[model samples]
Target: MSISKKTWLLIIAFFCVYVFWGSTFLWNKMAVKELPPFFLASIRFTSAGLLVFAISIATRKSLAITRKQLLNCTLAGFLFLAYGNGVFVWALKWVDTGFASLLASLQPLIILLMMRVIQRKKLQWKSMVGVTLGIIGMYLLVSQKDIISKEGMVIGILMILSCLIAWCSGSLFVAKADLPKNFFVATAYQMIAAGVILVIASLCFQEPWKSPLVWQDNTQIAIICLILFGSIAAFTSFNYLLKHVSPEKVTTSSFVNPVIAILLGWYFLEESISLQTGIAALLLLTGVYFINSRKRDKPVVVAKTKV
Candidate 1:
């Protein structure tokens, strides 16, 4: 039997989240090389948010939202994008792109733990094993002598971990929070709210902003890709998938992202993958698999957004 149109759309959406979202690490790394993290993130989100709005209008979707929804959107934006993403990108200043993606692969583990705490749910056998492996993998990844010896490495790792917490918190919020009926409009609201806050934060931090015209060509191109593909297309696809598929299935991106990121970093940036990193990746990704693959008493539907 031939696939339906909906099937095709789902396939396309999955491809966007898998490939485009994974490539965001490289794009963010390139942009952050010359621009302050807040500045880069602010511009990227604001521009992408506006573009999303434009798309909404072109498609004749209503933009109206309740006051409560707007507030929820703002909070989600700050948690997911402003602090979660901005600081993560900042950490990239001191961390390798591939290494950072591998760190991000731990998000599933973090989210599972968050569920245990917030929902007061007991961990299953698989979840417990997964958490144990995740801890061991994290230690192995960060405790590497060559990685830890680098200046600012410890700080970078800490910041990324903090960002993971923020992101996991946002994921939990978005699952049950009231927001716009239209996912695109909701995303636009979140992106714009995040962009505005990032702008203020960038100012407060005394980050000198320069005209985009003066930015290096590669940085400019990377920013464009971030706006068009990373923030807009891939994120929309992610939201779409969460609605159409089980959250567990959508979360397979966690596994795919790091592998794609590592390969891209190696091919494009010549980043090395140490034997230690490979072992750590095996353990971490295996833990993620176990956590995601565990049998459930009921269907667990968790909504997760991207980097």
Candidate 2:
């Protein structure tokens, strides 16, 4: 059967988000070797934010928003983009890209728990099973001998988990907050706010002047790729898919990303995946599938709108 053009576009968006986002772990690892973690993250989000904001202006997207909306966006930016991406980069300093990606894959699981606690909603059976499996997976992945040998691995893991929590919390906040009706305007403002905050943080934590300008190396290429594909393309495609498809389906990208990251890490970084990693991947993916699988209730339909 021939799919409609809109369906095809959604498919393309899904591919971009799932594949590009999965590969970001590799790029992040490469970028952090030369660039300080927070600074690299700051530059990445800032550049992407500026680019998207400029495009929004060129396209005549409205910039006007309430102070309350701006405040909500600022909170989201600090938590999700700055702290979330920041901690992921910092974790890369100690962990392999594959393992880091594996750990990051726990985001969905974290979100599930957060929802239950904050919303005071009872957990579904499937969700409980999923969370259990995910926790097991995390244990297996973190218990690796190589990971243990890495100095500061524990700290890195904690940082990455903290990042996950912050990101998830920010996501819930955005969902509940009063924001602009326009997704495009809201996203643009959030990116701009996040970029500005990251810039100030980067300046405070990292003296960019004293840091050698090493943009001429392979790491620069990685950073460029991160900014372009990971930040810009990934976010754009993700936002697009949210407009066209079910959020649950769009979120399936999370489960798919870890597998791809593991394979890519094995291929590009020569990182060896152990039996434990495979088992953990299985458990985590199984759990995620259960948690995100169709709900008995009718799915909510989000109307088509420009972002």
Candidate 3:
């Protein structure tokens, strides 16, 4: 059967988001060793945001917006980037990359609960089942002997959970808010706002300059990769995918990211992948599949406009 061009585009967009975002955990791990977490995030987002903003202007993309839209974007930036990603970076100091990814994958479940509570959306049975499976999987993943002995594991887990919750809240808020019709412009605003907030926070809380500027060759390479692929490519593709796909489909990134993170951890960091981690991965993947596999009676259409 021949798929429509829109379908093909959607598929490609999804592939970009899934694969690029999945590898972000590895890049982040590499960056945090040499760069202070918030400082690194601030730099990554600021660089990407400026690049995209310049492109938008050059291309004559609509940067004009109402005060309400600006406010919404700013709030989302604080929630999603400053707090969500900021907490994620902080958590990595203690959590293994695989474990951090697994914990972060709980965003979908958090989104479900948030929707039910705030929007009065009814809870679906599949979501409940997915949440249960995910929780079980997290238990299996974190209870490993090697991971449990870490001094700050509990704090890391809490921070990661907070990250997931903050991200979900930001996502839901953005979904409901009146924002730019152009995804790229909206994303640029969000990133810029986030970068500003994160930079300020980093300067005040982290005092990143006081830390030795020792950049190992590997760390420098990792920083470059993180800024390019993790910040610019991954996030831009993600926002692009959202323009073409359903929110449910977009959430699949969370599911894919964990599996990629686990594999990368094994390959790059020489982290041990126990049977429990494998089982947890399987359960999480299964849950995500079931959650996203529901049939859509209507075809999704994409506008031919460029962001």
Candidate 4:
């Protein structure tokens, strides 16, 4: 590839991961307004998974995998899309897209803690401070009187917070899990497994499906956008970025995505952001920056003085 062509490709890739992924927050909120959350997510993920699998096959990518890899994909799919994303879509009925994004942005800090606690990895002071600040941000965001006043607001927020936990846990697992060597193949399998699990969960939850909602144009558009842009385009671009740029650089989308989500919510959804929300967003995003950007050369150990 020529230099100019590569530059354009890089820019387009960034846009895919940044803007498309960010816009899905609002698209998803719109989708749930017409259909049940679990049902909405199930359809979106199932379509996206099939699309990705077809693309992988078309590209002649290796689809071979071990039994353990399939099991790992199943476990990850259940944790992430089935519980994490499914509940998130449901919670959008109560929480605005911007607030949801702020809550979701807590993933980096949560992942940092997961690494420390679950993997028993030593972390730097930055991680500790970032997590503390993130918790404080969470408190401030929820402390808004309007938030607490709404019926089921606490439950909605808690569900979204649990979404953060599940998403972070899944990320950790994906980082270390034994899966297909190809990133796209592994992700395709993960989505297929997750789609099946979510659809079953939606059925068990008795999400309304035969309603007039199935014919809504806005709902259809939102689902299509989510499948095409959010899942397919973003995943492909992210994997491409991983191959071309440093992982740290690609992860900057975490910062940009929430900000885009907030702006899109305010402009498109007319979601109000209170002063407290703004301050909390600042704190939360800063904490995420610290968690992802700062690095300790090694685990710090304080030597005990001989008594």
What TM-score do all the candidates reach, one by one? 0.95, 0.90, 0.86, 0.91
| Segments of candidate 2 deviating more than 4 angstroms | 1-4, 207-213, 294-307
Question: Could you tell me how far off, in angstroms, the CA of residue 169 lies in candidate 1 after the best superposition?
Answer: 1.1
Instruction: Give the 10-residue window scoring lowest on summed lDDT in candidate 3.
Output: 298-307
> Best-fitting candidate, measured by lDDT?
1
lDDT of 2 by residue, 182-244 (tens): 776777677677768877877887645324364647787887787778777777788787767
Model 3 spans > 4 angstroms off:
1-12, 210-214, 243-250, 294-307
**Cα lDDT of model 3 by residue, 122-153, tens digit:** 64677668778877877787778777788999
Q: Which stretches of candidate 1 lie over 4 Å from their true place?
A: 1-4, 297-305
- Clashing residue pairs, candidate 1? none
TM-score between candidate 4 and the true structure? 0.91
Clash count for each candidate, listed in order shown: 0, 1, 0, 0
Alpha carbon lDDT at 176, candidate 3: 68
State model 4's lDDT: 0.80
Candidate number with the higher lDDT (1 or 2): 1
Which portions of model 4 miss their true places by more than 4 Å? Answer: 1-3, 211-214, 296-307
Native-structure RMSD, model 1: 1.7
After superposition on all CA atoms, what RMSD does each candidate show versus the true structure?
Answer: 1.7, 3.6, 4.5, 6.6
